[model samples]
Target: AEIGQVDGLLQDFPANNQAFRDANFDIEQLRKDIDQSE
Candidate 1:
């Protein structure tokens, strides 16, 4: 649910946007950590 909202926000940025890329990377890492925790 929260991840979906974050993905939607990421989509709102242009493909070339650096911040969006960084955020995507961070989100990917976060997902990995969450999966590992479970």
Candidate 2:
């Protein structure tokens, strides 16, 4: 069951990544926010 779940996640990863990029997700800004809180 775990193996099947992993396989599904692997198959979905590219689509998920594309959607994440399409949303203009900003990693640098996130890091900056984290830095400010620290």
Candidate 3:
């Protein structure tokens, strides 16, 4: 069903967003750590 597919996509959107945010945050933390070490 198209509606079911749409709902599934919507549900996945937040998870994807969170994953991206987490990755960005981790990268930022690593940058800070490296800067501190230098």
Candidate 4:
């Protein structure tokens, strides 16, 4: 998913936000990686 898309989802779902952080999902880094891949 796009960075903004996921970020919005997290904002709308607090529990998911916590789980995302707990899982070590680095959104910024993932965005950078995706950018470079493209």
Candidate 5:
């Protein structure tokens, strides 16, 4: 069961990583827009 849980986490890692990257990109874009507005 523990091994299965680890495998499940491994399978989810890529999606989680992608989401994190997308969030960071959105944050960066928002910062840039705010800077431009200032």
Candidate 6:
């Protein structure tokens, strides 16, 4: 996705927000990035 698309998603999707509620994280794209790296 383009930066614009990601930025838009971050703006619209509450789950996509990077704000930390606790020590845990969203882990939404972690698998995707890890797969690509592998």
TM-score of each: 0.56, 0.58, 0.77, 0.35, 0.93, 0.34
lDDT, candidate 3, 1-38, per-residue tens? 69999999999999999999999999999999999999
Model 2 regions more than 4 Å off? 25-38
* Model 1 score (lDDT): 0.88
Largest TM-score belongs to which candidate? Answer: 5
Better lDDT candidate (3, 4): 3
lDDT of 6 by residue, 1-38 (tens): 99999998877777534344322343646766788999
lDDT of 5 by residue, 1-38 (tens): 69999999999999999999999999999999999999
Tens-place lDDT digits, model 1, residues 1-38: 69999898779767659878899999999999999999
Task: Please list all clashing residue pairs in model 6, or write none if there are none.
Answer: none
RMSD of each: 11.6, 5.8, 1.7, 12.2, 1.1, 11.6
Model 2, global lDDT? 0.88
Best by lDDT: 5
Model 5 per-residue lDDT at 12:
100
Q: In model 5, what lDDT does residue 28 have?
A: 100
Q: What lDDT score is found at residue 37 in candidate 6?
A: 95
Model 2: per-residue Cα lDDT over 1-38, one tens digit each: 69999999999999999989966667767878999999
Q: Any runs in candidate 6 off by more than 4 Å, and if so which? A: 15-38
Clashing pairs in 3: none
Ranking by TM-score: 5, 3, 2, 1, 4, 6
Clashing pairs in 4: none
